[model samples]
Target chain A: MWEIARSNKRKSVIFVFLMALLLVLMGGVFGEHFAQSAETGLLVAFVIWVILSIIAYFQGRNVFLAVSGAHKIRKEDHPRLFNIVEEMTIASLLPAIPEIYIIDDPAPNAFAVGRKPDSAAVAVTSGLLNTLNRDELQGVIAHEIGHIINRDTLFMSMLGVMLGSIVILSEIARRSLFFGGGRRRTRTSSSGGGQIQVILMIAGLVLMLLAPILARLIYLAASRKREYLADASAAIFTRLPEGLASALEKISVSPIRLRKINQVTAPMYTINPLQNMKLAEDSLFSTHPSTLNRVRILRSMAGGSGYDAYDAAFRAVTGQTRAIIPPSALKTAHATVPSRSRRSDPKSDPGTDQTKQAPSAMGMAGAVLTAAVLMDAAAEPVTPAAKVRETTDAIWKSRGYRFIPCPCGAALKVPPDYRRTDIVCLRCGRKHPAASAS
Target chain B: MECPVCRESMIVIEYDDIELDYCVGCMGVWFDAGEIELMLGKSGIPFPSEALRFRVADTDARELRRPCPLCGKTMQKVCPEHGRVILDRCPAGEGIWFDAGEIREVIKESAGAAGDIVLGALRRYLGEALAEK
Candidate 1:
């Protein structure tokens, strides 16, 4: 894992440099064409790059959380989610548990963001929480932690910002050209070196138009491989390949598209929320490898839970000689596969009895018990409605909504900004003072 | 969420883990698609595939069209197979909007265990409001 992270960091530096060069070239060309000064264009582009980098480096995680409409939640708010994250953290051997966040959107998706594992935060949409069971949720969480472990989050953010800079620069250039900047350039350049200036201007215009697409291509090419690695890591961490396989299946087939996602942040998610699942084949523009391919590779893992098994599965499923996991990592990783049974099921595994004597075991047991009770209490056994309800309630609670329970068995959730003093129950018509209910 | 009818902010009312956005000003209710599914699925109610097969109702041409609260698009009016109630549904299938007393009317006219459960819950919680008229 450390080797992977080190190599990832090295690749990230190289990628950043390449993108920076692209930004500078684009800037210089645009500036030379528009301002008739290459130095000024170069300077402007460099400044934009630096400002974006600084913002991404320092406040990128918070910016992502805010933009995605994610609200930070304490452990008490959604204990199931927090517990799942915690279990994955311990399993992954992460330095600290990443802060958890919840997005209110019903589209099932999740992403992790941070410069480093210790400072990381993992956010899942309410739909993901509502849709997935414990094992599937663990699978998704493990994949995210896998990204954090491989330092993919940091690389992706920096790359995303650079991509943003290129897109913005090109957009500005395009708009200016569209709105009569071309006429001004032609007028100014017709004096001396007219032929060469005209040629250069055309070349610059072409570059400006292609820069964003070029940057996006580069960005997409680099990200797709890391997703497979994260999937492999998720499989290894959870020791349950089927869990993530099923999760990928569910997420890919979900009919609801994420409402808050845009192209730039779309690559950060477990599956590209912006991309149509039907068109999710390996492509130059895709931010992720095909979900079908990923699920197949995970499900095809023969026996081992190590990187070796994952590499073998990858080759077998993709029919490619090139290994996804590095040979060195494969050599170091011991071939050991844990039993595929649900590890969290206390009833199925009596080993939990021995672990229950430990202090932390109590909390784990309680969470499991609570989950069990909730699942059992549901009238329909398969829908996981109780879990969905709990997840949504947690989201509401985090948003500072005051929960007022009516004697008639209806719960009234008054928005924090609600100025009304009284709320009439929809089920029983009992009027309750909002301020006094709490 | 703002009410589609009155444009006033609505409060959430939850029963059986299902949340409905209730408008105080218009006495309307918004049932989110996902939440309704969860609620129905929880109560062991089999949601008919054709239940939400909404078509543009031509009879309510004189009525003002309301925008969907979830997505600010003009909602299409649809009359369900079991009821004469003309409900507003988002074109994007975000949810259904019940105006004023439309929920009770739907409950009274609709048949099956699903309607019974919904009606019983509504009567228990909003007894006085539903009893009026």
Candidate 2:
């Protein structure tokens, strides 16, 4: 179980206080109506708020799915993708099958959200499929399952809906008042309903403006701690830290970054979705712990046989044991993954080849190792980052660039960056910028 | 198309005319970095929004990574996120590598973002035309 940090707990308390403030402000506005009329309007208002919020809880998934335009998929359209999800779900033993959605995108990414596994959803971009091999793909899928099983999906979605409601309602209030919510107040108070009513109406308008901020405070309170819990759960679900490490590395390298994803919904993913912070700078406002930090934690786990390593990894990444996966049961739990596809695409036929070994493009381990051993750690991420005098330029020099997918099963193929002006792919007939300069 | 990983000869069996140069051997693609955008053209992404950049992330903020897979030199990194999706941009501006199923993910993630990008661009284009009028 993930422990809630004192800092976060205090934040939650503050959020509840803000909520209480919003309600109290509302009560003040209507207090007058009930004071004069013996109708129990305050009781009625409170009931209505409770009823609507409850309804929202049950139906929140539908709204999120629809708004995000996530479409459901069967194992048929994408058997490999679907099977990986199934394996992860069974390994995690989640109560209900989370809805799987596919978005037509070129970016390598995936996310989980909804009220519960029963109402949970897992969405992935088409690009993720193209980028990862079976093992790497399985790692990402299991990570998503970790989110569902831990109920982080539900937590984040609930928070997103709550925040959405605040924004939508405040916008409505602003519009209605402009058209006239105050019109009724003016008419109702005409007979002598003087200063107090005007003051109350003003108060209501001000509350309307503050509602979205209050909603966010609630989300921030609810989010940060839950992230620590999910990370631990992910590590438990997928024994090999290398798989996730590789997945993150691939995601990090892909040109299409996930910018549309936001704070309210980001916690539902296996990794933090914030794009602004550099990996090194992530200890501060990032909801998901930094990838390197998580990798370090996992690497520590790989090295140690005892509980101390686990403790150290958890504490270092999460700052404390808000959530934990015990060594005993966690070890026994069989985290599952889809078996590799043995099918051979003639182009990347791995067999009958020698000399040039296919770039295993496995985890960042290859990169990390190369960095740790061959080059300084400081220069490692730099090679993958850009302009490293590596093989990227050599391929272009011999022949005009071609848009060929590598043997890795990654669907995209790029040309050299130096010759970036305009490219004519002899094979694909598509003209593109050299190495995606756009 | 060339292989993105090892940049060798490749053949794309999926989709019509979208013969990506993937190393039939290594399973990587040669995106030519900018080639991905040329392939996606106008109809990219999920539901009315830009996706590629918004889907994956690299906080290191290095645009330098964009480069030719074959040359082993840095190519320009474009977000491939489609417009403001804004991931690492390839300055060399050619080709992209969609590791296997990334094409599907790119389209799926871009659903909303693509729609938004298309509409916005069309609106701006038409607005510019009207202004000229």
Poorest stretch of ten by lDDT in candidate 2 chain A: A367-376
Candidate 1 residue-pair clash tally: 9
**What is the TM-score (0 to 1) of candidate 1?**
0.78
True contacts kept of 2: 0.00
TM-score of chain B of 2: 0.43
Show where candidate 1 strays beyond 4 Å.
A179-192, A333-340, A343-382, A418-424, A431-438, B1-11, B23-125
| Backbone clashes (count) for model 2 | 171
Per-prediction backbone clash count: 9, 171
Compute DockQ for each candidate against the true complex.
Answer: 0.44, 0.02
lDDT of 1 by residue, A1-438 (tens): 555677677677878888888999999888888787889888878788889989999999999999999999988778878888998998788999999999998889999999989999999999898788778899999999999999999899889989999998998888878885767655766578888777887898889878898999889988999999898888777877878988989988889988888889989999999887543568888999999999989988864566777889899988899988866566553233332445444454434433345446544312211111113221222557677778888898888877888887778888887777787776666778879644
- List model 2 lDDT by residue over A27-55, tens digit each: 44444432432244345445555665676
User: In candidate 1, how many Å is residue A401 off?
Assistant: 2.1
